[model samples]
Target: MPKITYIEHNGTEHVVEVPVGLTVMEGARDNNIPGIEADCGGACACSTCHVYIDPAWVEKLPAKEDMEEDMLDFAYQPDPARSRLTCQIKVTEDMEGLVVQMPEKQI
Candidate 1:
C-alpha cells in the first residue's frame, strides 16, 4: 500500500493508506476524505475529483491524456501545470508519500 496525503483548502490534511491498484479518487472516498466528489465514479468524464499534485510529485505522474485534459476545462480553478483528475492517477508503490491539494471548490 501507498500513503497519500490530501490537503484541503483550509489546510486540513488526511493521510490515507491506499492500496496499490486503486485510483486516487477511490482512495480518498474510501477513507472518508472530503473534497473529492468523484461524481463520475473515476471516469475521466467529470472534473469533480480534480486536485493539484504537490510540486515535488508533479513530475512523477504520467502526462495527462487527451480526455483528462478536456475534462479539466470544467474544474473549479484549473491550473494546467498542476491540476489533475484524481481518478486518472493510480496508486502505485512508487507513489508512497504522495501529496495532493484540493481546490477551493469542486463544481
Candidate 2:
C-alpha cells in the first residue's frame, strides 16, 4: 500500500495508506477524509474531487487527460501547474509520499 497525505484547506492533514490499484479519490473517500467529495464516483465527470498536488509531487503524477482537464474548469480555483482531479490518479508504490491539498471549497 502507498501512503497518501491529504491536506484540508484549513491546514489539517490526513495520512492514509491506500492499496495499490485504487484511485486517489477512492483513498480519500474510503478513509472518510473531509476534502475530496468524489461526486461522480471516479467517473471523471465532476470537479468535486479536485485538489492541488504538492509542488514536489506535481511532476510525479500522470498527466491529466482531456476529460479531467475539462472538468477541472469547474473547480473552485484550479492552478494550471498543480491542480488535478483525484479520480484520475491511480495509486502505486511510487506515490507513497504523495501529498495533495484541498482547495477552499469544491464546485
Candidate 3:
C-alpha cells in the first residue's frame, strides 16, 4: 500500500494507504474523505473528482490524457498547472506521499 494525502479546501488533511491499481479517487472514496465526489465513478465522464496536485508532486504524476484535460474544463476552479481528475490517477508505489488539495467546490 502507498500513502496519499488529501487536503480539503479548508485545510483538513487525510492521509491514507491505498492499494496499487486503484485510482486516487477510489482511495478518497473508500476512506470516506469528503473532497472528491467521483460522480462518474472513475470513468473520466465527469469533473467531480477534481483536485489540485501539490506543486511538489505535479511533475511526478503522469501527464494528463486528452480526455482528462477535456473534462477538467467543467471543474469549478481549474488550474492548468496543477488541476487533475483524481479518477484518472492510478495508485502505484511511486505515488506514495502524493498530495492533493480539493477545490472550493465541485461542478
Candidate 4:
C-alpha cells in the first residue's frame, strides 16, 4: 500500500493508505476525502477530481496525456504547472507518501 495525503485549502489534511495500482482519486474516494469528487470515475473525462501537485513532487509524476491535459483545461482554479486530474494519477510504490492539494473548487 502507498500512503497519500490530501490537503484542503483550509490546511486540513487526510492521509490514507491506498492499494498499489489504484488511482489517487480512488484513494481519496475510498477514504472519503472531502475535496475529490471523482465524478467521472477515473475515466479522464471530467475535472471533478482536480488537485494541485505540490511543487516539489510535480516533476516526480508522469507527464499528462493529451486527453488528461485537455480535461485539465476545464478544471476549476487550474494552475498551469501543478493542476492535475487525480484520476489520471495512478498510485505506485514510487508515489508512496504522495501529497496533493485540493483546489478551492471543482466544477
Query: lDDT scores for all predictions?
Result: 0.94, 0.94, 0.96, 0.91
lDDT per residue for candidate 4 within 1-107, as digits (tens), equals 98889999788999889999999999999888998888888899899999999998899999999999999989987998999999998888999878999998889
Per residue, candidate 1 scores C-alpha lDDT tens digits across 2-63 of 89999998999999899999999999999999999999999788899999999999899999
TM-score of each: 0.98, 0.98, 0.98, 0.96
Q: With candidate 2 superimposed using the best TM-score fit, by how many Å does residue 92's alpha carbon deviate from the native?
A: 0.6
Q: Which pairs clash in the backbone of model 1?
A: none
- Flag regions of model 1 displaced more than 4 Å: none
Off by over 4 Å in 4: none
Colliding pairs, model 4: none
**Model 2 segments more than 4 A misplaced:** none
> Considering lDDT, which of the candidate structures 3 and 4 is the better prediction for this target?
3
Error of 4 at 100 (Å): 0.2
Residue 83 lDDT in candidate 3 = 98
Error of 1 at 93 (Å): 0.1
